[model samples]
Target: MPQHRNISCHLYIGDTKAMEYNVHNVDNRSTAHIVSEEGQTFSFKIEAGTALMSAARLDLELWADGYKLDCFTFTESVYEVDDAQVRDQVTGAIKIVKLRFAKLNTVDQGPSNADDAEAEQLKRLGTLEIKLWRSESNVSQSTTFPYADCPLQTPIHEKKIKGQSVSHVTSLESKGTVAQQSSWGYITTKIDPYDRPWVAFVFKHASKALLQSEGIVPKDEVKEKGAAVASAKGKKAQSSRAKVNDTKNEESKVEDVKFDDDVAAMSQPQLRQEIMRLRKRPGDSLDQSVVKARRTMKCVRTPDADNLLSTAEKGDKRK
Candidate 1:
């Protein structure tokens, strides 16, 4: 029989306490001895049935002074790191180890509601490969990651291996590129050109409507005030033109009639009669008078018969 040496180690349990244990040498095997400060001792033997410890039993307690610790039994197994022959078995063993550590760490600290924390730690440690498999197609994909680079925020960049379609690689790569391009890199604001014009218009209209709704002043009143200003300008222009015409008449030594008020008061029929009389006067060009009269006319309603005759003549000329 080969002699085995006990391996002793100390570990911290929770935040304020520590645990101590000793492994005793046996017949090509080892036994763990755990001692508590309250004069308590527990013993368990590990048999060397296989190269790796398939099953283990442990007695755990706190070693801190003045604190009463609860006793618990934990069953575990050890596995070789590079045992490809029993990869599934090792994977299951590693999962057990992870669960045990999580339970032990949270025993005194209440519930470890940090799902992301454990996942991130596992990712950083980089000891295991997690996979997603499709049952119908019998295809599988696996990803191995480093513990520190695990996604603490959204999963942006992580290595992935796929067992099936080539299209999946292209899709994932394209998605990753788009994600990287759109990531928030010290930029807090973005302006969209398509939305700017409409947004500005909406803001201006909203402000104007709010002012009117609050009884500040109605838009109708502003429009009426603008029309009054335009009317004043038109009256000033007409008066200036009449003064120039009056000066011209005075320089020619002609007795000019006071026709400004008469023209202003004349209705449509009387204006047409005056235009005919002016056209019939001596030295007046009838063609020029007719053009001027046509230019000054308002709302001329031509006979439908005349319109039809004009259209018929135009069609005849075209034919």
Candidate 2:
């Protein structure tokens, strides 16, 4: 009897769910379909391989989701090994492939306006997942690896014991399984929760470098700028309203000061004496009345004006 290995691949962009493919026995050609963000179904074929062959091949053909990855290629040659190499593992290794894609559009997770900076950021975001199992049956399974879990962008920490170097480490186990889901070991810098870090499958490749070159910064800056702009607008509105209120009140206060001839006839000394007398002889002792009388006398014409008026009256009588 011929030994058969079931091949399956699960693809995810960020933490968002994508598609899965399963094929039984690596003997002939198999087909799978993926629906794009644009609601179009595109087909591709997976060519089977034997143990002696260097690598398995994937023939991808797609023109949907505002992306054109017709000739997208991948290889699975690492599984072909001698019996000596297979003994090093219990369940064997899970093959993971990460690729970088640009200028791709997502259905509802991106900005509505295509030209926005946020939209550009979304386009820069890519998908990455692992090919979980190769079994005897066609049963399919899928799982998402967060950006923090990705080897390409995993955060590094230096532990010190009295300022001595201990060891540099990653979250994955020695056999490539995720050791734990701890925040200390991971750094997820993507603004959108659904977006994943850009990581290429080639072990020598680094995706964090691409992130720096692409000018990906923390989204906190965007929020800070927006709040500053709103605060400035509020201050400007308050100033404008104050100016309008001042202008409106100017006309109504034109006759706020009035002069009385009888008040002007009294000298400064006499006026002060009269104010004091009124304070002393008051039936109702509300200090508000005294303050109002003093303010009215201060607004009247001075002693010079009283003398001029008296002279004018005498001249009129003589004529």
Per-residue CA lDDT of candidate 2, range 29-121, in tens?
Answer: 222222223222112222234521422333222222122221222344323210010111334333222233322222433333444543432
- Overall local distance difference test of candidate 2: 0.33
Candidate 1: tens digits of C-alpha lDDT, residues 3-84: 1322222222223222212334433222222212221112222222321132233222211111111222233232111111
What TM-score would every model get versus the actual structure?
Answer: 0.14, 0.26
- Clash-forming residue pairs, model 1: 123-146, 123-147, 124-146, 124-147, 124-148, 125-147
True-vs-predicted CA distance for residue 23, candidate 1, Å: 87
| Candidate 2 residue-wise lDDT at 235 | 96
Query: What residue runs in model 1 are displaced by over 4 Å at the alpha carbon?
Result: 1-207, 210-229, 249-319
Off by over 4 Å in 2: 1-88, 92-225, 244-255, 258-288, 302-319
